[model samples]
Target: MRALLEAAGVPMAVARSGLWRPIHPAHVLGIERALRQWGQSMAALGAVAAVRYPERAAVIDENGTTSYGELDRRVERIAAGLHADHKIVAGSKVAILCRNHRGFLEATLAASRVGAEVLFVNTEFAPPQLAAVLERHAPDLLVHDAEFAVPAGIPAVPSDLAALVASDASAAPKPESPGHITILTSGTTGTPKGAPRVPTAMGLAGLMASALGRCGLRSGDPMVIAPPLFHGLGLLTSMMAFFLGSPLVLARKFDAEAVLDQVEEHRVGVIVAVPVMLRRLLEVGPRDLPSLRVVLSGASALGASLASEFIERFGPVLCDAYGSSEVGIATIASSADLIAAPGTVGRPCLGSSVRILDDDGRPVPVGETGRIFVSSGLVFGGYSDGSSKAVVDRRMSTGDMGHLDQAGRLFIDGREDDMIVSGGENVYPVEVEECLARHPAVAEAAVVGVPDEDFGQRLVGYVVLRSPATPDELIAHVRGELARYKTPREIVVVDEFPRNATGKVLRTKFGS
Candidate 1:
């Protein structure tokens, strides 16, 4: 598959950047040796980076910068410690619950090095929720931050980078095969489900090519990852940085001004964050962050108003990606595409196919809203509990309702389950929310359907305001932009919206 893609000019995307730089004979031998020792997991990728760019900065955290050489040595020792002290071995499940930083990367790479299945646990999980996850997965070991309280009866390891590095154990023996990576869903609707991933060589290559082409990320550039490492968007970008030998500038906690400070201080080139982070950065006021070339937003809806407002303030650096844990990054919209087609999520990535299908499993016409289905190598096989999304024509449903323009750009209307029926009229809350967001006073808005006696289900909006605006005025504002039926019946003004770790609004928590 890599050969086929390379033959068809897909390789040009990665090759144009120095990612395809020729490996020295010694470095090639080192990579080969490391791959044999660590399998083909993230550990091998880190080892290759260390051999090729030993002196290059691999991670910049609160403790300061750590070069690739130092990171590699630390990872080896950590892997050795986990194996020697904790008996973490091949097929062992290693749950990682930590914020974004060098420790998160260190724990992840070290676990992979020891051939353990890495389960990225959400840092925002409540104690009960965390216990439930641990009980279900029953991981062999849990590596977490010092700040977090672990569940009872789980063998745990601290995610302290210095402590792990200080260990003097030798490296663990190579496993028979590479281990898996499980990323849990945001669980906004209910209990979080694990989406396990084992990337094939072809799939990784295709995804890398697509991301590099669309995101304009080059090798060796410093990148600021502001999102939580446990989330898909953050994890993917961090892995991409490791793959490209790019220095990752990480913040333990996301502060909008701190992100800008990091970008300015490190002369960073790429910024990986979710939509909420982007909004926060904009709220921090404008600064001359000229070094930043790409601001990648994902993990939630990027409304037209927010996209336009961000681009207006930061130039054409915003790139919105649309995907979920079930499906890896399926679509990406560049700054120009966002400006041209406000709600578009851009075209299908390279080597991936997308189709909009109606309820009957038939393709919908261009500009007609339907279920979004994607077929890509990056898509996960199934949930950890043996459940799988329905597949049509070998394409898995993204569980999103969207339409494609004549030019093939995708526009997400809302989630399939988010649709509300009121008085014989179908309404997608996203439309109403987007309309509300356009209002000057509204900072963020979320709409959910409530049981109604007359209307069957009525729309109720919860909004966080940037300026003063009455409920009547906000309702009138939505009425002006959309049909009367699409307008929220009630607009509740709030100081802030309840958000998950990745900044996605928890609609379930609203009005409760």
Candidate 2:
């Protein structure tokens, strides 16, 4: 058996070991369990890392660096404080209303340790929408930073929670498996829903390890946390970094000048930001951002022209990634992939699969447009309210429409929910928006299908003009470029677009 293994090019060490003694299956299982038990929960991971690397700076907040040891101890004490003082119990929902900061991480981990679900309220929401979330979640306890002017009944915890993490390392039971972390994701239709995910399924460790491997982020490598922790991209990416023992310098919020200063000051190597944030950064223009090695852009559909502009200014470091709350990191348009397939969302990650299907749920031929369904080990289970019946057997339709080439490169056309059928022809809003964005006068644009008697549905474009221009002139410009049917029959120029809490354009409210 050993000679046969050696003939197949098996390692000599394994062959010799097998010849000497039979390997025990139980021993392998024991090692797997040991690795798993190393730490799964955010709180537990922080605690373990704190013990393993006591001196390493775990979090760089506005105040200064907070060591892992200090962060871990703070999580414990905060958990204890919530349990003992606030009467919080297992399964109790707690609303966290704050931006990205060291306190946000501490509160999340602490709540996780006590089996409490943390409802991360979108800070951008107006008073009415915020109240709606509070009503829906019905949080047992409310915790916010000093900046939040929270109403009565929801008591504020210590904003600097790192001070309390050391009090109790042995916290109570927490659901550490699938369906623990509840993140909010709005649908193409309906209200914003809660998307729950398992730690393993979300690839909390995998994303970090992969990013670290790609970026070569070691102890000394610097990273900038540009996205807010309240969003899933920020929360999971931060957790990924924490899992792989990476150091990150946190920005209190996304600001172009501040981000540039942070990269220069900390020598930041990696940065993950949205297209809007990148647009703002580019608006400021590159002035010797010497330390940046990699930039990951996601959270919205990226324009090919915009991406090329960014690459021209900042070298070939910017990578466009694609994913949603229901599905974790789906496709990553890596730097190389961008070069090969200029506008593709790239291939699936380490253990994920993608299926592009037609309207009838059958797989479409390569190069045919279809709804993008993803199946992956990293896929989240379902929404928090259990309302999502469409997601089944680890498969989720991202509500986005796209096509995959024979080479498996995914090309997103636009959102499936936002498709407009005019004069028996289908039009994708993203395609229209992309064309509009190419216009020098158009700063931003959104296309939505409106109700129509003759054509079933008509395309109406909402635009934010950069330079002064009339709606008729914009429509005429589009008509000159696109097919007459593809051009928006009606165009309305607005100062700004109506966006959801996470900066996504809301089309349902258009013309209302």
Candidate 3:
């Protein structure tokens, strides 16, 4: 217990978080009070930072920078307004659908302060999708950006972040509970489902240890979060910023050039993004960011090729985070790990456990692929719709097929359903996809399995080309690297791929 707390930066700022000074006694009490009421949540993090780093810069967005003190003041008033005017109180469900900006943070923090159960809605949802989510969740109120229109008759506070902050409402009373937060899963194949969970001291402790120890992140450094705040990657990283007293930088939309500019301007020490965003940064090329020490990738698969290419250009700074919305962050692979074993996702975090289990619930030997099961302290309770993931011996299934190497490093092969048996041999599509991505002419690739009369299943490839190359030539390239059966039967070249809001390729849209 002491080790966990110490590794999580409790008791001393200099101990683990990289801050040099001591936390004042009075400020510590204030943080303690807020945390006592808010639990280990974003609301408490914001409140604690307000008292601890009052004058420190807290947020930077299109509107400009807001210090911790200023941001917290706004959060208090907005919570008060929601309580006084909107009648949103503890346990009331509130939905948020906004891009990566101050509004998203304010809405979330304010709702949390009021002890409201906050649900982060994906900003990329279409009207029908959004409407369906609202209907199912039946949140008391919807807090959304001005551009997004909600279904008729639904209560909402639309694009009034500035107004809420400016209001002179009295402070809200203390609540009975810290309240729960729901983050929707990335619905790659079907409608997104709500995964509700709250942060606990134990959960945060393990995650903090991994970030500070393995990822080399320090306290009080500026951080740029390129992904949407609604995502687990951006949301969790934003909380890390609050805990470390770092200046949090956000942009409504990802632009590679703008991200580079922010890194140089802020001398940002850390950046959090998805793999696709990292690819964009690589495409836009490198920048002189001496202060940047960590480029954290999460919320999606990071191909070995992309990981290798990124580290080669940016020095040993790329850290690949592996987890799902349900499991939170189970493991983190440092750049050194990527350099040694490019496909590895490193090891389990400080307080987490990972195991590869065969279909019969037995452990698999090292270097043998099996279903990935994880027990991160932050795992969700269940889906909002009352369905839960399959759990074996207290650990939840990650729904991914992977193997651990001799050094205890985890390497994801692909999704469990994505593995195909071709010509009596099982093949993970990621191998073919990565093989295709290695070709000089191919920029990105996605592999899908289709029914085949002779082979039972055959792989089909879809690629976005960086340079001109014939399909036959690409197939020949793959055949040279992997087994003949692992090569795609057809390579359909396309100008671009159908991706979700976070830039994940959607194989469901493709027709083989």
Candidate 4:
């Protein structure tokens, strides 16, 4: 453990902060009972929070606030209700398809308490995609919000916040084994795959230490989570809040202005969101949000222009985290690093090993691009379909192409599959996209390869413009900054780009 901590670059003082603080005898007893009931899983994190900060607010959602003590009791009753009425016993797979709110947490905790594996369904899934996921997972029970339409033949229960908390049953079900959490990958390239994982004590501790040291976040600080909880960034932040006894403020939907309002209302110190959310928040223009100390951006690339603009307008609160669903968090770049390194994704987090590997799985030299592989305790073992990512020397491939600088900062070039071979020259769309984004008129851009009789493959750029800019002008701008072959063959200016729930541009949806 000491070596792992040191490898992660975590200071010894931060490592000591992972130790348990003194608590009252009564709280200790409650924690012990929770430990015996839920084992060392995420459920136990919630249990410890409830005992340590019973009077503090655990969650603040659209419905109102829930104290930690109240949340604990509600989870117990919901667990009992699921067991008594739904027959959700140990090993049962409970698929939850709700937005961010108290009910989502309630259903998750309740399901885990009974040793049932929890699958967090993406709320933005299309009907066919949702149906296919349901068919594939074959969950025993589905707990969902009233707003969504559930597929026929699944035993589903309503997840209304009021109704769930008003249940009469107060007894918690004891799980036979620790429940596992399954987070689905964002299907930007293809069908989303499930990454199932069981949390270990050492893994959780390392994650906590790295997050604390990188983000400068302390336990018990109020936090606002703006991304979907089903995603890796949101889920990890929520788990950290529970473990640290921090109050989590959630919203059913993400509205940029409303997020600012909530931060001011709750005096939140940390704001967790994806890069698109940060862009939207900045679009709302500058305002007084003094309580916000850290802005954690993840789930997608944070382009250099966007990061600089955000930090300039909102102070040095922006922190970019680079990772994926398969591997938890690998690197975190602070505001200074964002400005100094520009497009760099910062250094590896504590207890994480990141390497750029060539085709033969050999390490690439610094400043050379290759497949990004990471070895971390928080990485998932495999997908639910019994398939796993390629592992070399205990390191798992992140499916991203990147390189490290002489300063040890990591910079993502693009997705390995997104590389385009045009006119016998290799081009990464991210480089072109970044060049286009630096233009004053461009708001967002996506580049994809299309079939061409002459070149075999050609680059086509789709852009959403904030102001007026001709296609020819944008193409010329890219040509000026990058190689002629790397420049888009054609540029199309559009009002908007097709994006997923988390605001990732759907390159597959780009029209020919």
Candidate 4 clashes between residue pairs 3 or more apart in a chain or in different chains = 8-350, 8-351
List model 2 lDDT by residue over 53-96, tens digit each.
Answer: 56677888687988877776677678877776676666677778
Counting only residues 3 or more apart in sequence or on different chains, how many pairs clash (N, Cα, C under 3 Å) in candidate 1? 0
- Output the better candidate (2/3) by lDDT: 3
- Give the Cα lDDT of each candidate: 0.82, 0.68, 0.82, 0.81
Candidate closer to the true structure by TM-score (higher is better), 1 or 2: 1
* Model 3 alpha-carbon drift over 4 Å, by segment: 1-4, 7-16, 186-189, 418-512
For each candidate, what TM-score against the reference?
0.81, 0.73, 0.81, 0.80
What lDDT, from 0 to 1, does candidate 4 have?
A: 0.81
Residue 3 in model 1: shift from native, Å? 7.4
Residue 283: error of model 2 in Å?
2.4
Better of 2 and 3 by TM-score: 3
lDDT tens digits, residues 1-512, model 1? 23544664767776765766567899879978987887667888888889989999999998899999999988999988889888999899999999888888899989888888999987765565578789989999998998878888999988885665777887788888888999986333445678988755556665677667777778888989887888888888888888778999988888889889888999999998866677678788779987888888876677788889999999998888877777788888888899899989898877788999999999999999999999887899988888888799999998889999998999988677876655424467776787789999889999998866435467999998999999999998776555565778898888888889999888889877
For candidate 2, the per-residue lDDT at 258 reads: 86
Best to worst by lDDT, what's the order? 3, 1, 4, 2
RMSD of each: 10.0, 11.2, 10.1, 10.2
Range of the 10 consecutive residues with the lowest summed lDDT in candidate 2:
11-20
Candidate 1 lDDT: 0.82
